[model samples]
Target: MSQADHRSPQDHEHTVHYDGPSGGWGSLRGIARIFGKEWATPAALETLARQNKPKGFMCVSCSWAKPADYHTFEFCENGAKATLWELTTLRCTPDFFAQHTVVELLTWNDYDLEQQGRLTHPLRYDPESDKYQPCSWEEAFHAIGAELRRLDPTSVIFYSSGRASLETSYLYALFARAYGNNNLPDSSNMCHETTSVALKKVIGAGVGTVVFDDLKNCDAMFFFGQNTGSNSPRFLHPLQDAAKRGVPIVTFNPVREKGLIAFTNPQNPAEMLTGSETPISTQYHQVRLGGDIAVMLGICKHVFAADDAAKAEGKRVLDVPFIEQHTQGFGDFEAKVRGTSWSEIEAKSGLSQGAIERAAEIYVKADRVIGVYGMGLTQHVHGFENVAMFVNMLLLKGNIGRDGTGISPVRGHSNVQGQRTVGISEKPELVPLDKIAEQFGFDPPRDKGMNTVEACEGILSGKVKAFFGLGGNFVRAIPEREAMERAWRKMDLTVQIATKLNRSHLVNGRTAYLLPCRGRTEQDMQASGPQAVSMEDTFSCIQGSIGLRKPASEHLKSEVDIVASLAEATLPPNPRLKWREWVDNYALIRDLIAQTYPDEFHDFNERMFTPGGFYRGNAARERIWKTTSGKAEFTVPDTLDAAGFDDAPGRYRLLTMRSNDQFNTTIYGFSDRLRGIEGTRQVLLMNPDDIAKAGLQEGQMVSLISDAQDGIHREAGPLKVTPFSLPAGCVGSYYPEMNPLMPLSHHDQQSKTPAAKSIAVRLKI
Candidate 1:
């Protein structure tokens, strides 16, 4: 392997500690640096100002809810980066591809590959020339259509990223089902599938129950596993606001995330001038990696014990009435919690009984509380149970279906939840397939479809023949990188619909096509007029995103248009579904969505652009349990060590994370300002004691080998070790880079989501 493949050299002489608060001058500088790097013009600034506005596009960086009351600058630092990156003038024209062959391009780093910029035309791979050549859109579509016609529908994987607008995602799902399969594995499969699966099973809703207003009114907030500083910076604003209001915000995460510690709101003039920072987390506990469930169990145990004491004093602590009326399985769940020993909790959680009880004390004191978490809680073998346990904690006091209290799984991509809302899932029961069949006049596939892991397996076994990527870098984002790369190339066809060049494009199949699509910030014009697409945020709010800037390339088409055109080419024209009309008029697509999911999308177009849009309305928020039990159920975990990782000596639970510069496999830069790491994504963050125990010094290069029992040896390195404030048995590294260390089979059996956050590994010098 080349040095670049394993090593990431430090830019600074030593790790630079950023002492300043999160999102003050540091954020401003970061924004400036990104804008300068992208060569963003004054027009880009004007366009950014419109982001998250009533009439503007949604920020593409995160799924954080946009407040109804918009600030002067609603977008955050990473949001600016996402917008500027999209608004960049650079173009990956045919000349650029001609200059570099597929093999040559494969040698380029992911950041450098995307830095080549927006794809301006439809391109097709030529095996003879070993380069991608420009081709007409019609030719590309025809080739894809012919390949699909030849292959069984079950063999075709229709993959989507969260970047696609709701209208586009809705259409993509329709097209895929019409072409005759439900192989709709999306970005959610890698991250928050656990949240959906667990939440749906317990509460009858797949999405978060809280709204933007909940943050403002919430008496106290409990955050687990999520890092707001890197993944969703906009959320820090509310956290800061809540802090200033004296709302106790308790956090339990392995890493001491700078965002949760404190924040300096750049938009606040008083704080900016005074150089003051608001302390966000009242109590921040660094739990062991994959130990959230244990910590949660301990908290619940403490709460139950407190309730027993309160009963003797004639003061009821638990919301007994609410629990009795709206929930079930409490008796069995409480028994399980009471049975779990504190010794096991401390051993597994890497936290003391005092720390766990302290958190419980805060939880019991609050009248209303919100439980917020991210992929840190979701990307595990028991990720589904992690979410269920969190919900159980909230349920102890009737936290759900009330103001200032609910569960919020902060999503990564801006429209990831919306994609699922509009019918993007491997499971047919999750979506309105029968309604779709009735509306579109086609029998939608009923068999369970392939998720990310299953799709990778299918590809490797030569069962999956075609890959239609709507927006994500699928090959890079998924686990088992080396295996997937080899399997991906063997596929019969791969169609990537994206705005810029990424690594997935270079990993070409036998027949490959790259169709350039318009970015979310660009004006999408069709036969009718200027068009707008809707996106659903983590808060379940459906809002319209209308592009304000000119198209990057005249040849570029909207995702809606592209999906429709591809559908028309692949499927025989259905009289009931007007593909041409839907593409021209996006409103018609929304109408179809409303007809299918009337409860959520009623009068979709009418309310789409209504100020901050409309809430799709989560049933769980209304205390309506859609589960088979007809009540919110409390789930009991099988064990404290949720992932069931063997307690082997010298073994470390590897937690893959994102740097402040990146957003879900898209590397923006080398620096992770919050972690004090600079110019390297390959450095592993470890506890000082653990580093010394392994006879490894800080900055020492080492290989991380997966401890999985699978026959295949999974290893990634020479990653530099950096001593930091992580737990003794845990280590942290950037994701996608560390994805190779996680075996594809190591995932949540219930949700099928890869346990990226809790891979078992050991260092090799």
Candidate 2:
């Protein structure tokens, strides 16, 4: 029997997914977990082995978008498993829903809620029937249009997921704009808005300041909170190249990622047979979660001191020649670093003076350095500050606008970068606004729109009326799932542009429509014959992708077509964005992008022919940073708060994380062997000493509850307890399950990203 048959209401509590070791620390267990314990279920492995036959297809969810020249098991374990999970013999067909009401589906666990398989047809909720009945795509579109026709254009908000292609995202923005709405709430709001916001303030462009080729020449790397080995294995090749070149890469996080220590590329024959792993981190330091600011300051102080000592000893320092020529605000920044005390740094960072100095020594000795960050840096209350501090360090050594030294924000999704280029943003400069207004003939609104936080508050207060999700499951992915659901119900209408049924689909509005669209793995045929979608990589390179798989359903339309249909339905008789022309020829969409963002994509057609990808403009490399002063400026940090902590007695600060086999909201399997977790998704990690102090034993049942019932969604009961060497006051669990426990209020002030790393909760036994 499947898991759904046995679970009770409490089973939907915080999910505890596991990632077994395949080649990392738990390599033996990982292998055993996949090949031994899971051997009985060989459907996914079989599907991958079958598809391993030289299909020149690029992965849709990650940055490994190269021409598939050698497709021999080229897919990682997680990617393969995801493919298997997709091609599963299991089917969540129309018959399955015939018996289950939308309310019943809401009560269903997320795992089983979705594993019902690819949606076979479009669906809509009938209040009288209480069940989701099948509907045609055309009917569903009309239903959405009729409801949308009733409201003011600005009343509706558009939410996007990273899964959309440039063509689709561009079409989405066009549809929403034509309908007169500018509130584009997206997954970016929940993850990297801080990086974008901070970069826009300092560098003028809100994108990574470095490229893929830059990794080869870097002399040292400062990486924080990103577990590249598991989340996205493609990054390992470049990191390994840096390691072999003797470049020291330092890591600072609350928990040691097994992949960060040593990772073996499954592609290397020598590594595969001998099990030889490439050593990654030269220096690994564990800092308390949310202590990123102190840790960064400590590094800056040491670097500044090293420069002073070098000058005192009459040694050459700073490419000082370059520093004076290219940067500004050094004197003030140096004064702040020097005036800062090591005691304060140590206290706030939970690190000793010795460790901080060692990190600084590495930073100073390297001729060129790169600072790489991920969600951990962006998912805190002070995330914007953390990103700004990283830029500050790059400026100190005149390390930017060059080949090796800069800041790289390793984005989690494939097209989040492309979406920005396609105009999926609430904060756009006047140039694009004017250009679009000229092209479409509707004077665009220049006023800033609502971000994720503002959107949530607006929904709760009955300011925003309707919610339109382009592709993401926002209700589940947003901060504080419970509150979001309540806010969702207050809306006049909620529409989901989706592929399959998910928990968010059950979150019905006065009227809800689930419009099925083509998946990333399938072909997208448009009016101009079969079309290829484009996406930009972490390096700001735009490349085209042509999905090879047959679509899950024949009636499903591409997201581009759906957007166009919606545009035709809601616009003032004659639309402004020329949605008709853009959808007819996606090439026209590219031409518009080229004209709108001229500095980046000058001639989109010329670049469209190359599948390798097109690189965006580099401000640092041009030494033409667009800050107000026309030079790189270092901003001062906030005053120290050394003794301040967010937890109380029995109340642990919770961090919601992912496993090896998972993406942002997709589950491939139910195990995380690398961390030694098994059987269930309700487990929590803590310090062994802390567990003992609480009189808790291994495998003991317990419950975790937030101080207030206002936002927490977890119905977790007493669960088997597990202990690891996590920070004394912190606890860790997987997301979607943990999403309920976190609130929209507990977020980085500037970014509004959920503080998944620091939330106060109590344990019950």
Candidate 3:
């Protein structure tokens, strides 16, 4: 074994993470309560409600479940009460805010903070009144417009939250540009921007290549760094279907989540009656943090060897015909794989040759296979390279845009992809921008601006003057909380177009405004009629969505209206820009979108009604890729030098993650039900041997400080130690809480996603 192998198991002797929280002495009891908590599974019912029942409302969180499966009482544990809290007949009117100061309200926890109920009108923070005073929409827009006009265009940043509908997102971008700024710092910039940056560059498509139907046809499936059971429960049905059909599901993650192993289909009445759950992954690999790329490389190497062996035997090999016709750079990629040493592969991946070979056998035996990966695959230092490795494996078997064998980058938000499709990007291509400019009759600024992180950084430096958001808690989502808060204070105007209140509304710029927008579950009626917006699923299939619930407040306007009013208030009068008419009709937006990208959006209205959804960007259909050479290119990552991080004194690797109930930076209380964690996000998960080696007993409190060469120090304070079965030496903790420990600089070189998996830290007592 290589020397790198020597330190990991020994390191494991020191730390580990759990699927749930367990406390000192009372862990058994705490765990039992969680298991017995009777948190009824409502995902199946909720999904069913959206379709068969025709409620038109959809959960803003997950996407795998069919809308027809939605139920009226249906609510997942995470979905429950909170949805009511946001969508209920509750109200937080201007009068309510008249009693509370902005400073006074800051003391409330997020749940307690927003459970104060929903906003009923437009509000502006009044320092004089020491409270948020109700303001007229026109009044607020003018105040914000004046503030925006006073600043350099580059000084203004525009952010889009994922859950915002396509209509809203398009207007948000339009107004930001008409207001003269392109700093589109959005939710994608935080969550799966890595996937977009990686996959688009790798396979010529930014979104996942597979559709929902693709799941049923795959011969072999991989669950890479994804916990489908809780994070996306609707996927449990497909996983069960795939597993029962005898297709193997292989998983590689730091922890062994039960959902990946066996999942009870809340949809399967017989299975629920018998307490029988279908098993997903035939095999699971607990890859150490930062170890996925190596595991992937090893898989690619095995595929290379398998193809060679089949060639020697003169047998019809795994997708050789597909590879030859559809993919490029296979020869160079194969050579690179062949040159990789077995010793290095096993040592770096923390896997045995036996395990890798077993996986390789499974892959080779399958004719049609799909690889499903999550943040775990894309949130690393070499994230793009990691994605390339995944694509390389598919190309070896020719799995591009096929029935089942394709790449699925499991998305975290319901409509993050849709936001991008409808022009929410900071960097709009010249072609699209030119068309938009022609329609609006304004010379659109073509500056490539800052993303989310860069926006925070720019704001901190006072380069950013104002921030306008369609929806989202910006200060909470961006990394380095301290820097983000500090930067936000410098903004001249901060606007939040949202459904409910979040901490970010409180991240007050010099002048702040909150304009509530209708949600996915709320009705949107415009002059044209009741309008429905479309969202792209993880499968790259675009489908339409309409809402059924009444607006939380009668005053709430659709996101389209908010953008149109803002644009009118900001831009000089131009007959070319018909703001009122555009907001009144969404079909015009679709027409403009189709005009901007005829290749992708041609006859956009014709396809929007198809409940089956529309196919996007058909590189697979033509077997012609749009990469550098019009073919998928083979990329070889330089060997990463571990000596710099490992040789340091008193240092270990730290990985930041999330609990199932939580979404993004929104902390849904302090319990990780699936992993059995409760009461705190401050615990450090470690292996048994690592506990002893660190001279730390289970539940011991310790601080963690970073020792990276990059000159950033990470603080993991007062972490409670718990032992779990994870591979040794790597430590795990939940995110946002863990964000401070991962420096903004420690990101994927290509995608700029924080190498959230491979942070180095010094344990403290």
Which is the leading candidate under TM-score? Answer: 1
- Across 413-490, the per-residue lDDT of candidate 1 in tens digits comes to 999989998889889988888888789888998988999889999998999999999989998998899988998899
Model 3 weakest lDDT span, ten residues long = 19-28
Rank list by TM-score: 1, 2, 3
List, residue by residue over 442-529, the lDDT tens digit for candidate 3.
8777888788767767777788788887777777665667667766766778888877677788778778888977766667898988
Cα error, residue 113 of model 1, in Å, equals 0.3
Q: What TM-score number comes out for model 2?
A: 0.91
Better of 1 and 3 by lDDT: 1
Clashes of 3: 34
Q: What are the RMSD figures for all models against the true structure?
A: 4.5, 6.2, 5.1
Q: What is the lDDT of residue 571 in candidate 1?
A: 91
Tens-digit per-residue lDDT, 1-765, candidate 2: 123211211222232222322364343334334444233245435444433222233455665434323334556555554454544445566788789888778887766766776677777878788877888777877778888889887778888888788888877876677667678867888888888888877766688878767788889999887877567666776777777878888888776675666677666778777767767788777777777788888888887778778989898546676668766777887788889888888877878899888888888888889989888788877787888888888777777788887888888777887787778888746238888877777766666667788888888788888888887678878766786787787788888887667888888788888787777666677778777677787778777756656677787788888888887766667544677777777788788777777888888867754644668777766778777777776777774421124546677767778876567787645766556565567778776767888988867888877754464445444556877656667777787677776666877777677777676678877
Off by over 4 Å in 1: 1-17
Assess candidate 2 and give its lDDT.
0.72
* Estimated TM-score for each candidate: 0.97, 0.91, 0.90
- How many clashes does each candidate structure show, in the order listed? 0, 13, 34
